[model samples]
Target: MADPAALSPLAELARRNDPDRFLCALFAPPAQREVLFLLIAFNHELARARQAASNSMTALIRLQWWRDAVEEAATSAAPRRHEVATPLAAALREGRLDAATLQGMIDAREVEMEEDIPSLPALLAYLRGSAGGFAVAAGRTLGAGPEHLAGLQALGAAFGMAALLRGIPAQAMQGRSLLPADLLAERNLTPSDAARDPRQPGTAEVVRQLAGEGQRLLAEGRARAKGLPRAALAAALPARLAARDLARLASTANDPAQPPPPRGLGDRVAVIWGGLVGRG
Candidate 1:
């Protein structure tokens, strides 16, 4: 087993940077929660690589480092001695994780280093590659079988879309836009228009359309939940918050250009209740 002290930095990383996942981890099995935290922390590192990099090439280099780290963890008798890699290697040694899927998640962030705007199909594909892959890995760690992988991926995609929608303002600030090009074209808007200011006229419509698609996927994924193992439900907990957040974004009062309001007390209760009832 990995030392508890060695896992603290990963835990703190999750708590400070991804509170929704942090809260969800609280309900995971005690033995497995640390592994989940490690996985989520690794994801945060990959997702933020571009933002942290000095340039696009620098971001690609950072991603390559992680890719190599995961490859080593999978094949080496003794993995690299790094915070993220150490726990990840432990998970791999125990056969609780897959290196290929984790590598796929890392590879998917390649889009983040580019300035191109993806179409709706491309955007969904990217979500499946990153978030969907993460869900499947989390499910495996919880002892879910192959039968549950599809459902977990669907849940993850829904969660991913909602997350991308929530990130519009931040992405816009960086001059990046994840909104589908076709969707923007339909609104007679360009990627530059949305990237310059998400609050641009007709931008809300595009956001609403995307949020609707996210809600649809959320419903589809929830329908598949009945077939998933109860333990696997822990990996889907973020869907609870995603659902609430999409609803808020679709509302008239909410501004797409601003960060979504922080999760409230009621939101936390709902997330816990959903986790207990195996709803998300």
Candidate 2:
């Protein structure tokens, strides 16, 4: 049995991102490395929390606390009582991590606490949460070089976009949509029209088109990702697979004869390994 205390706060962070689970057998860290994923996972969770909140005030409060915790860890040599922050500081002590990354992570989360990002361009700006912040964190894990950092930024953007796409269904249901409202309007889809049930053909068509756009973005990002830092490449490849599989699933007919995309681990691995990882 592993000693619970032997694990650090960063490990706890990985759990926040559900890093242990993979859809397919394609690309993943070895089991031994699984324990090291806590910090990345935790950062993902905090980012998600900030994004999901409907209220700016609530988001601001949560971000302020996280920011304070990060600051606390940066200055003090010892572990502070804060959960995510303490382990982060501990990780830095063990490794030659950057000060800017830590501050960037906090700042990214802080900005997302407010919910005003509505357009495609604005959405790109709002992505400091995963792309900008995690790019720094990812560099820390992958030898902390400039190339690695740059790769992680592109990788992080691809990963963040995958999650953003998932929220479309949920957002549609809530009537507070995020499908690049202008884009949807241009596609002849009113906000009211896209929110219709998934079983309906219209909604399914919208998903198909959106999924296509997502794949296009992933393709462009993946092309840029080649020759990136190996460590950063490791981080980004999984999302590439995710985007491919999701696009395939969305492209399928919404009819009962065709099943929806795989929600299981096996399908995920197959997609990643079967050349879908980098395919647009």
Candidate 3:
């Protein structure tokens, strides 16, 4: 278990907003764990930008602010003074994180603000940049070798797909749907209609197709992770949680309208078990 006193404010933020990563971080050595916390917390902040903003332009402005902050952090001795930025700047300076990859993450979120995803390939690209890219950064922070980074990203994408599917209900309430626009169109549904009610005909099929893709990615990621260093396991461990969610998705008949059950003791136990096994 992670000691509360040992967690920095940023790490606590990760614990509150991104508990799966937080639980996985506990398996790392203290210093690496702190970097993991910073990375995940930074991601949580990026994810919130769209919802926090009153309009699309405002959301772009918020993302641009983070981009400038990241640029400054990578080049300047005196980086921005924000809580997350301070340590993130230190990580950028220390080479524990990469500037271009971080930039790519920002780009992904910017794309996410769009209502139409166009195609399945385009949607996967967003997942690759956002979740998969973030995992690659975290894996590096935990001393994962360059060779394992691609697999780490794949693992993260799998987790991202699961997360996206599970959040459909909440996102719908907010007038957003991440489903591929083309897929929805084939069913004669618009993004707004799917957002309003995922249980409507053809919506469940979209969810099913996405869930199947998530499972495929999980398998490929697991195969690739077999070669990762033992120390890198925690960084990739969220795939286990993804697997569980993907499985539940099938049991629920792949209903996008069905909200995910809250994470409980079983979820934590699964992370612990995945950590022990050194596979996600």
Q: Which candidate is the best by lDDT?
A: 3
In order, the Cα lDDT scores of the candidates are 0.81, 0.51, 0.86
Tens digit of lDDT per residue, candidate 2, span 152-204?
A: 56545555655655555565455544445455556666555555543445445
Indicate the residue-level lDDT of 137 in model 2. 63
**Top of the candidates by TM-score:** 3
lDDT of 1 by residue, 170-256 (tens): 888888787887889988888888889888757888888878888887877777655677776788888888888889877777678
Candidate 1 global CA lDDT score = 0.81
Following a full C-alpha superposition, what root-mean-square deviation does model 1 have from the true structure?
2.9
As a whole number from 0 to 100, the lDDT of residue 126 in candidate 1 is: 82
lDDT of 1 at 218: 81
Candidate order, TM-score descending: 3, 1, 2
lDDT of 2: 0.51
TM-score of 2: 0.69
Could you tell me every candidate's TM-score relative to the true structure? Answer: 0.92, 0.69, 0.96
lDDT of 1 at 191: 81
For candidate 2, which ten residues in a row score worst on lDDT? Answer: 20-29
**Which regions of candidate 2 deviate over 4 angstroms?**
1-17, 20-36, 51-54, 77-79, 93-96, 109-116, 128-132, 172-175, 187-210, 229-233, 249-262, 265-280
Poorest lDDT segment (10 consecutive residues) of candidate 1? 1-10
